[model samples]
Target: MQLVDFFTLLFMLMGVVSAVLVAFHPNVLYAAVALVFSLLSVAGLYGVLGADFLAAVQLIIYVGGIIVVILFAIMMSENIYRARFRDAAGKFVIPTAVAALLIAGFLKLFHDAKLETRAGLNAIPTTEQMGRALVGPYALVFQYVAIVLLAGLIGAVVVARPHHGNPESEAEKK
Candidate 1:
């Protein structure tokens, strides 16, 4: 097998293993860490598929942004640390059966499909074109999204801030 194929297999294995850990691990913190590895492996797969922009976004948005927030929340929550998480008895059988059926169906569909294989063709990079479009035609939509995110952040801060105006609130802080 080629180097690219080897790396693809490695990344696929890493992603699958980590995803399983994320799902089944009893510890929430460990599951979150596994989720980070799973996401990073997916980003690696995107890089292997020549989707550089997607890989970067996966790394930045999922791994960097979302995972950090999740980890911070997990660390900050005292209740989460004190609680023990476990699946109820006999709960796995149905989900396992469904997952098996879905995997079988997907495998059968893939085996029956006559998909064209692009073996040696180099993928033309579209990141530059996408950047140009985002800055040019899609700029307004992008700005609106930024504004919405900013508003949400501000709202979160306002809601999370302790009330200081009430006399009872001031007394409770002491």
Candidate 2:
């Protein structure tokens, strides 16, 4: 097998393992860290696909920015030790059924399509073109994303802040 194929397999494995850990890990902090690993693997996959800008953006925006915020949110929460991370058996039933249906549908589609293996996959560097599209035509959409992320950050901070009138704890005295 080629070196790129080997690395692709490795990164796919890493991403899947870490994603599973993110779902199944009992410790919230550990799950957050696992999510970071998963995101890094996705960035690696982007790099393997020759999307340099996408890889950089995935690393910077997701792994660097969002994961830090998630970590902070996890750490700052008061009942970290008391939190239950395991899901009940009944909770997984519907989701599992839905996932099975989706997988079966996808399989049927792929089987029916009988897609031919196309030779000479042209690798287009989309960095400059994507940048121009984002700034030129899709500028409104870009601004909306920024606004939503900012709002989410603000919401996180607001939710994490201790309530003033709650007489339950000694933390918020003001």
Candidate 3:
């Protein structure tokens, strides 16, 4: 009956469709585009669920920053256009089946246990409280994340190093 519920269902459906396309698409570029659409759809669902801050952050930070970086990386990498995108689904079949069984077992245990949610005692999580907890108590984790990001940047530069080998040697190898 509500507009939000309608949009939520629509967005969820769109997200699932795009995500499936992303997984099954033969071309990496198409897959990337599908993945972006999927992420945007999920962000829209977040907005429908009344988490505007999370929705905006998801769209801006993840969809904007991370996806753009990945797309750029795909473009910049060697043998991208010329290479064939291999479907690696067969590789995941056995492992995925095992994981699904494990997950089903967990769900069975969870449902059979009949755990009641304590609603009154628990307050809805607030962004302000989360920020305070992160900056105050988990400040070290913030620092660690910064270090990890820095290391990733360093690794990227090192791996993409155009100056690593002599031109003559590189030419000979090629």
Say which candidate scores most in TM-score.
Answer: 1
List candidate 1 stretches off by more than 4 Å.
Answer: 79-82, 87-121, 161-164, 168-174
lDDT by residue for model 2 (1-174), tens = 878778888999999999999988888888999999999999998877777799999999998899999989989999886675763636887988998999899999999996643124445787989999999999999999999989999999999877777785445554
Candidate number that wins on lDDT, 1 or 3: 1
RMSD of 1: 4.1
Q: List TM-scores for all candidates, in order.
A: 0.72, 0.69, 0.65
Cα deviation in Å at residue 121, candidate 1?
6.4
Of the candidates shown, which would achieve the greatest lDDT relative to the real structure? 1
lDDT (Cα atoms) of all candidates against the true structure = 0.88, 0.86, 0.81
For model 1, how does the per-residue alpha-carbon lDDT over 1-174 read when each residue is reduced to its tens digit?
988889889999999999999888888999999999999999998887778899999999998899999999999989775555563647878988999999999999999998645365455787998899899999999999999999999999999776989788788888
- The residue pairs that clash in candidate 1, if any, are none
lDDT of 3 by residue, 107-167 (tens): 9999899664432223344578768978999999999999998999999998776654689
